[model samples]
Target: MITENTIAAISTPLGRGGIAVIRVSGKDAIAIAERVFRSSHGGEVRKFPSHTVHHGLVVAPNSQEPLDEVMLTVFRAPNSYTGEDVVEISCHGGVFVSQKVLEAVLEAGARLADPGEFTKRAFLNGKIDLVQAEAVADLIQASTERSHQEAFQQLRGGLSDQINAVRNSLVDMLALMELELDFSQEDVEFLDRQEIEERLRRSIEELDKLIASYQRGRFLREGAKITIVGRPNVGKSSLLNALLGMERAIVDETPGTTRDAIETQLDIKGVLFRVIDTAGLRQAKNRIEKKGIAITEFHIEDADVVLFLLDASEGVTRADEKIWQQVERLSQKRREMFPAKIIIVGNKIDLGNQLTKGSFDPEMGKWPLVLVSAKTLTGIPQLNETIFKAVFDERWERGDAVITNVRHLQALQKARQHLGFALETLKQGLSTEFAVVDIKGALEQLGAIVGQTTPEEVLDRIFEQFCIGK
Candidate 1:
């Protein structure tokens, strides 16, 4: 338990409301509150029972001048967040009032809490592990219902339990191997080589599954970046405005009107997509247009999905053919990295023409194509539905155990690599001692994901992402 000093902060967000909570924790939390709090119900705050609330008046410690009518609640050490004596002062929700009460608490001998200090104390004092500590921030910043559900599950120890289960098995195997070394002279075999190999292989498969799931997890957490690219005056901006259901981008019939990328976020069926409408992919005479094309290229390369727009009325021109060839060549280079999905969209369908059957050759793989007229607001809903289906397949599960944290993903990847080394070593008929080293290293990497073997710096960085007063 952390019992050395008290930490305090205004817990509620800045702005006016019915009330705001100022939280304090540490060994001296109660004492610090009592020094500046005066009771309205004629009971001493310092003498109040733990986990109970009392109406009170906040006053200056030296003069006893009442500042605000308040309610003070107390939690004894080892039972509260941070495992220390904690106090929550309920004051008027006015911004100035909350700030004044917090300042008073600090004046009465409590230090200001840093960003995520309360949660950090909880982690340091063993209330929660590092994975749960990170979940606190994730839970707050979650933008979608699916994200919130996933983060809450992780906060409840879903990931930790899975990691610890694997680590415990590896530790047992290592202990048995070490025991064999101790009794080698006496010819006692504490562990069977074939059985150990089987167990390790199972762990490796499980870890591999987790690492593979990160592709979906990362997209869910960060949202998909979708860039719309096409030649000049192909209604790229109109398509963007149509998708967002707003006039977020300027549109004109003249070519080269869009000279920069316009980005907007949309929640399509609870999945966030950062859609960027870039300058049309065309040869530029103006310096500004050339720069915009460069930026468009940059967004295309970094996008998680590309909406390649084609002018259905004009047909595929030489420039359009060139862009399509470039996309085809680029897809080959990214085959190993799980590259973004591309959709071939034919826009301006309302230009007094009907798109016939077999508009584009399907022989060159199933390039998803959708015909839409941005001017008439036609086919937008279907376009969005297509986007969702293309991104999240039927196998995608929400609230399933997924690793969203990058550090955890990297650690899992390293652990998988180590497990591969162990398997290779065993296959080469190497000594059990060498194989054990690789096995133990893999276990340690997995342990770090759950805070069992994490470094101090990693903990510091994770907690630092939390907002102050969290």
Candidate 2:
């Protein structure tokens, strides 16, 4: 579909830089750009070949006064990002120059592009699908190499291909079911019950796999939360600094230096981890101390991996045992809801004559333990590896389609539920018409993932997360 009005935006981030890019798209993009941009060689911008770049100067429309020297790139209709005539002006990086250039384009008849309008136009014009459109935003916001790779794969249509494959299977089954419905009076069985059940089972299995990937996918997209919990002066803050390669938390000989939770992000082997250093766990000497300890416990509960540090030089004290008891109680209560893994870290091994490997109770139930010296950075690499493995123990291979978006996951879950209902109906020997209802419901849910039947409000919400220039 061709957009009627031209739109313009500063594609590059707003600020002073070597160069800033202003993008214009739609039917009148070329005409609008030609009116405000004067070529260095006195050539017309409209006559430039598609995908060609020319030296130019942006000038005010009425005054014809030079605003800034620029490099103009032309992309003609059916070949541009939005499948429309598009022009990009590379101007001097000054904020005023770029704004004035954008103003010139606006004054020449191009409207300001809204948040994600360029990408939205791509979707509407069939240049990309809904999933790929969202991937554009994901690619922009990706923080780690792993997330960037995932977003790149999605933008290249990996996830969309998987969803389309499953949807095609459902469409085929729906066709056969509809055929059965058309001949209901003839008592003709278009497809055997066994075959129908088998197809439904396979579809459900595919949906189930996508649904199961949400946890790891979410962790990959938004870094896993790792919280450090231990008694005072157990090197919790030191560990945080060592992992981040910077002093993110205050380190001192004094106990309870960290009176609140200090959170920072770290990238390990392409995966992002949010490391949180919390106040030491101990009996409250006063109301403020009690609040800090309470906050520490709360972080422990919500963490993806709880690093329970023990001072190797001091050995496990009675106070340490009490804290372990508290951790155990909380773990037992929320075992099903919050499945955060507990890793026992023995710190300060550089002090020498530290606790032996078997010093802790074997009853701790096989929690992974690593000995480290935070001051000397000894065994720190092993500690990092242990932390990553504790959270992502599943066998995941690259290039596999994973569901990182919560909306997609929810849709897959609903699709699985509907498939389950259809299977149950088939097993109960119900009418084919009854089974058709559940199958169609599953199809609709899957369609929503690709924006085939999604509500307009959902699209707005999803694109609103993107920056205005996207």
Candidate 3:
């Protein structure tokens, strides 16, 4: 494994917790650790076997004063997270004490680690792929059970296995294509054109599914956007508060109470949804309200799911009809995918005036209408289920790998495009060398997802987004 200068950073969050872990990794991790740590066992840090733990006290350099009691763990090279010698000091979690401990370690010949340096080193040293490295961040930031599960699975090589399977197929095909190129001068056909065409077609289909899976995958990664929109005093804000179980949006009887979009998070069935409560969709009476309407239109155009709130106490009125027209017109650019599905909501069902499929024009009637009373939260459980069913259908079967990263999705699309070109070359009876070029392009694109061919700048951008010492 590759080794570099010793780098140390607090692996745990800096605060007044029960304890914190300081990570040291590189060629001299154990040696630097020994300088600042005096083990109770009274042996050199390097002498301890790999994966061994010991009690120690951090000693200040120059003054030789004890800093704090800690438990030091040693990991020898070729077996550590970075595939290099590593040392971990579990110290008391205090703002001042952790700082002092880190300072002592830095003074003991260890350099301060940059953001994500530890995880970056793991990727650079071949301990993990780029997808797994990104998964580390996702796992750390996961807010719901579904997000956590996806990230954990990705880290455990679920996505990597899928990527490698597709990549191997391309590799096998490319080898044969190159072999065919070699036999071109001999007037011998080493590869069958029909077989190559069939294989390319299958590979393209596999890529298409992964690309399509990005819709739900993105929702799992970054919560879904659910915009509640309707005419004045249709209980949009109340619905938002009801769903979030908190008064996140101000509820007022007066119209245009919310002049701007108020966004809050709601977790339904382990999937996150960003519920946005916007100004009632109506003719603006002021400049601020006009801007709010524009903002509402924007949200409607891009929302994953829209809650078209209609007052169930009263049937659809002219104002509701006008707002529905604007919403339909603005949603032209919305994604035609599972996450883009909408559910029409009729609030104030406690008034015993819930609407049905016969309540609106035929076009509006095509959408599912759910009745609820935001004031009493009646039918909220049904509303949650309706919202969830709108995006995630039975298609979300287990073991079907879905890519959550946009970068991975783009890479797959570009790889699929190259493969498309390869199939075209074969179908057109083009030269073997042309197909070889296309296949190579596809290989590089696929390799970039797993970091085999990723550029340095792209790596920098990705790792810089990670937390320091992870």
Candidate 4:
């Protein structure tokens, strides 16, 4: 194994707490920790058994003064996180205590670890692959249970095993085909043309499915945008406040209380949404309200899912009809630009004898409608559940592999496209040399997913996102 210099860092978050951990890893990790550490037994710490903890005091090398009392744990090489000698010191949790201990370790001959160096060493030493390494960061940053579950699964080699299996199959087939090309003089059939074509088609279909999952995965990682649009005094602010479960917007018994677009995050079924309560849509008399209206329109145009709030108590007035027309025109334009999906929300359902069922129609079939009272929260749960089902849950199979990273998904898609070209080449009876080139190209793309043939800069950029302790 390649040996590296010792690295040290404060592994815990910076704050005042009961305890903090300092991590050290490399060839000299234990030795470095031994120099500044004195066991309560007053014996040589290097003689201590591996994977055991001992009480000790960190002392200054020069003055022999106690820096801080600590509990030290040691792990020997080939069994630790980085496949190297490792040591962890649990000291009193304080800014000064951590800094003093770190300084003493540095004085005793250990350099501070860079961001993500520990995980980088894990990857370089074969403890994990690139996908698993990336998942460590994702798991740390995951905001919901579902995202945490996905990240943890990926970290345990779920994604790596899937990609590597496909790559191994392609490599085996390519090697057989190449061997046949080398022995053109004899009639040795290494790969049957029809059978190889069938295998390629099947692999391409599987890759397409994985690639398509990225759409839902991206939204799961990054919150979806849900813009609330309606005329003045339609309880838009009230709805926003209710969804957030906090008083993030000003809600009063007056028109246009919310004169600006207020945004907050909401979690539904472990999926996040960037909910924006825009100023109620209406003709404005003042400069500030006009600017707010302009901003609201802008948000509506850019939303991933627009929640067009209609005043159910008003029974769809002429102004409400105008708003629906505007939404319809925007929807049609959006459909042409991209696949735009929206939800229609009817508010103030608690008020009796208003907005009878099927009273107004936007004429666009399948426009989902929900009755809600943002004040009483009578239908908020139903509305929240419906929105989650419509936008977030694409019903991906439980055990089916899905590529969540955009970079990996793009590479897989390009690989699938090359597989298509390879299929066409084989059907045309092109030279075996030309066919091999396309197959190799596809193989390279597959390799990029697991870092088999990825660039050094790509590796650096990926690992840099991780925290030093990880």
lDDT per residue for candidate 3 within 136-230, as digits (tens), equals 99999999999999999899999888888888988998887787677778887756899888888988998998898888788899998999999
Clashing pairs in 2: none
lDDT at 266 for candidate 4?
93
Question: Which candidate model has the greater lDDT, 2 or 4?
Answer: 2
* Top TM-score prediction, candidate number: 3
Lowest summed lDDT over 10 consecutive residues: which window, candidate 2?
329-338
Q: Per-residue lDDT for 1-470 in model 1, tens only?
A: 56577889988899999999999998888888889888887887788998998888998777777889999999997888778889999999999989989989999999998899999999889999888888888888889877777789889998888888888888888899888988888989987778888988999988977887776677667787888988889999999889888899988889988888988898888878899998987778888888998898888777777888888787666788777666555544443656778887888888744343355545323667788899888888888988888777678676567888789999999998888888888778887889888988998899788787889888788888898887
lDDT of 4 by residue, 1-470 (tens): 53568889999998899998999989888788878999998867688778999998998766778989899998887888888889999999999999899888888889988889888888888888888888888888889877777788888888888788778888888898899989878978888899889888887887877787776666666767788888888889899988877788888879888888988899988888889999887889999999998898778776778888888877778887788777766644643423446677889888853664467673733667888999888889988987787665457754555566888987998899889998999999986667778889988998888878889899999887778767
Q: Compute each candidate's TM-score over C-alphas.
A: 0.95, 0.95, 0.97, 0.92
Question: Compared with the true structure, what per-residue lDDT tens digits does model 2 show for residues 427-461?
Answer: 99998788889888998998898878888898888
Preferred candidate (TM-score higher): 1 or 4: 1
Mark the regions of model 3 whose C-alpha exceeds 4 Å error after superposition: 334-339
The 10-residue segment of model 4 with minimum total lDDT is 331-340
Q: Model 1 shows how many backbone clashes? A: 0
lDDT scores of the candidates, listed in order:
0.84, 0.88, 0.88, 0.82
lDDT of the structure predicted as candidate 1: 0.84
